[model samples]
Target: MTKIVVDPITRIEGHLRIEAEVAGGRVTDAWSSSTMFRGIETILKGRDPRDAWYVTQRFCGVCTTVHSIASIRAVENALKIAIPSNAELIRNIIIGIQNVQDHVIHFYHLHALDWVDITSGLTADPAKTAALAASISDWPLNSPTYFKEVQDKVKAFVAKGRLGPFANAYWGHPAYKLPPEANLMATAHYLEALEWQKDVIKIHAILGSKNPHPQTFLVGGMAIPIDPDSQNALNADKLAEIKRLLTKAGEFVEKVYIPDLLAVASFYKEWAGIGGGVGNFLSFGEFPQQGGGQPWLPAGVVLNRDLGKALPVDHRKVTEYVDHSWYEYSGGAGKGLHPWEGESEGKYSGPKPPFQHLDTSGKYSWVKAPRYEDQPMEVGPLARLLVAYAAGHKPVQDAVNGVLGKLSVGPEALFSTLGRTAARGIDCLLIAREMPKWNDQLMDNIGKGDYAIHNGEKWDPDRWPAEASGYGMHEAPRGALGHWIRIRDQKILNYQAVVPSTWNASPRDAKGVRGPYEAALIGTPLADPGKPLEILRIIHSFDPCLACAVHLLDARGNETLKVAVR
Candidate 1:
């Protein structure tokens, strides 16, 4: 048996290292480590409560909105204030837009490379790819010359400056086996989808004033209002355009994205059965409504350890355990208590602990294992889709059932690694189909001139004196995200973030329980130990944002360490 390691898996976000012991053509044991940390929680101390939302969003450029919403909800929980109905609806629309747009970009550009070979494009007959696409999906005609023109455009973009991310890629890796024509078509759509998703974000900037990090929403209500009679009101024309953009996104999903998924699935059918991780799943629910109404998404857990039955998630039951990390501060090996009571002091001063002294039972990573009822669970698109389906969402049910029928697996597969990737694409298509209808509902509310607003009007100032605890939770693009905070005298006293990756990419717990990622990597088959793209295909399928979990060791014959983005 040989231990294979792929550290700093390139071309995606953050630092990730996968070490798997392979023998007899199967991964026997695996450790997935996210080796960095940015003290965003430490930075939040003593800042204005309102500014927490703005600042926390910068924690990740990829899903900044998710962080922003979680921060705002934390503050709202602390203040005990509810946002207005219109504000809630608008926030949902923006969140849905980000979710859909991110999924498109992920499927076409980032994750697709795992399945489609870019080097294959060199041998592809552009005419043949066009013909294939036309025959499969009845796609709008693209002649041979049109494909050539598109190729030249991509080449020009690559030449002008940075190829952005696709630069210096190992495109010619011999193991990449897709046919050239399929690769060409996939690459073409990848470039096209980039522009299409960017346009979707334009709608966000029009309403929220930014793209990567939007700024319209606050705790109690939106900072920007869409009054019918205000000077810069959201006019009918702008509303119509929003509707049009959403409709176009839905059309793209129905016509292009779904076909692309089906087409790509045909070539990579083996993936359907590979990388089946721990089937435990979780979602915190999302998209608020009026009058203490329910959110569009619901919170729940599907535990494969419990035979795939949907389990209710109690916020109070969640806790983090830091037994396997490098930290040995307070709470050495116990349940992950609330962030408001978290300890951040580092106890170690060594580059790497003596292997014999390594705390296998406690302190392995900076990320905490958030156990819902003391169990390792998965959270992401697949979790959300399953929760929504179990909660009786017809669209989610239909789409997921259809995909499962195609894959010919029982519903249990929805909890696996491949299911996470497949569910994300299908959910994106579903969200795209639903957003225009949501926009129309918002427009009708506006047409009725319901411009009422709230700005923390009802909270008692004296009761806000200081020293309070609260929890913030939201469904991010990847999955369930939450922040638990404590405030004293208008300053943050304590803070902890339970991000999506913490749940999905966590290490073991106090009792030596395997994390979702570790268990998922167990059975993955690696064709080449040096270039384990198969392992990456499973890892990146979760879209990990581990800028927070990485750290570096340096030496001048003395131990010095640093933590930063890779």
Candidate 2:
């Protein structure tokens, strides 16, 4: 048996390294390592509590809204305040827009490459690709030349001396088995998705400003008020365009993306059984409203492995163990605590000869192992699907059912790798369709003289309860995201964050239980270790945002990549 490693897996948002114990034809053990650590939590120390909203959002450009929401919620929880109904609605719309853009990008550009070989498919008959695409969807612009245009653009990009985005790609690798026609169609959509993604991002900027880190979200309410005189009138024409585009995107998912996914998945049905995890899932829930009442969606963790059914996720039950990390904190493996009170006092320094192993049991990722109720659990689309499935959401249930049926898998198969991936596309479609309704509602509220901003004087830290701490959790596009903060003497003394990827890609815990990504990688048959399309397929299925995972910097404070293949 020999172990093959793909460290610092490229093309995704963050840094990750995958190691698989390959014996004969399959992987018996796998480890997903998240290297690098950005002291974002540490950055928040001594700053105004209200500033947490803006500062934390910088953690991820991709899912800044979720970070903003969670940060604001943390301060709100500390101050014991509730936002107005209109504020909740606007926040929902902001989050929803990012979700739409993220889903579209993941489907076309990131994950699609793993399943469909673009270079191979680019050579196929554009006419056939266009015809097939047109037959599957009602978009009026599908044409052979349209596909050819996409190929031209891709070739242009490569020719322009900038294939940075397509780095490490094996353009014509034989294992990338896909018809040229199929690749052409997918390539066209990939280019289209890049454009569509920017359109959706505009919603964030108009409301927040900037792409990754939005500016409008504040602790009490939206920083940007919606009155006509506040800045400008709510442009009905622009809002309508956004709504129309979102609807069109949803339609495309149903008619184009879903069908394409099904057809391609048919050619790679073996993936259906590979990358199975520990059958555990977790979601902190997202889209918050006033009080504890339901927002557009609900929050909770599905500890099905323990309860045999999804249960209410308790934020207080989540803990982080740094035993495997390069930190000096010492305690038992399972300790449920918030980030604010987290202990980050260091015990060891760089190249600390005592700890260099990549295994969590000894040496591994800089990311701390995050556990719910003393156990590792999966997150992201699959977890959300199971939660939504258990919650009995009609649209989610129906859409997932359709995907499973197409794959010829039973409903119970939702726990597997293939189910997680397909479920995400369906989730995106459902959420995209839901966003416009929210936008309409928010606009209506504005028409009624409602503005979400809460302009009261900032709360006094002295007025806060003595020694208060809590966990603020929200769902990001990647999956469940949370931060725990503890405040004493009116300044943050401790801060810790258990990002979505920590749950999905963490190493083994003290109990020897595999993390979600680790467990998912087990038993995956490798047709060709040299061409790791299957590995990338499962990894991208999680839509990892490594910016939210770990970061490393050199003396100049610039992040550098470390390549170590085992």
- The CA lDDT at 250 in model 2 is 73
Tens digit of lDDT per residue, candidate 1, span 280-373? Answer: 7788888775566557777888766343355677778887777775555464565576556666544443236323222333454556666888
Which tens-of-lDDT digit does each residue in 1-566 have in candidate 2? Answer: 87777866766887887878887777788877766666777777777677777877777766677878887787787667777777777778788877767777787877887877766764677788888787767665578777877878877876786777666786776557678888877777777777766765777767776677777777777766565554463445556766776676676676767777776776776667777687777876766554556644555556654324557877777777765655545554444344554665433333433433355347466667778778787888778777877777677778887878878987666666677777777778778778877778776777787665563444666667766675677877788888777777777767677788878877776566778777877777777887766677777778777788764333234546768899
Give the lowest summed-lDDT range of ten residues in model 1.
548-557
Worst 10 residues of 2 by lDDT: 346-355
Residue 241 deviation, candidate 2, in Å? 4.7
RMSD of 2: 4.7
Which segments of candidate 1 are over 4 A away from where they belong?
151-164, 167-177, 229-231, 305-309, 347-363, 459-466, 548-566
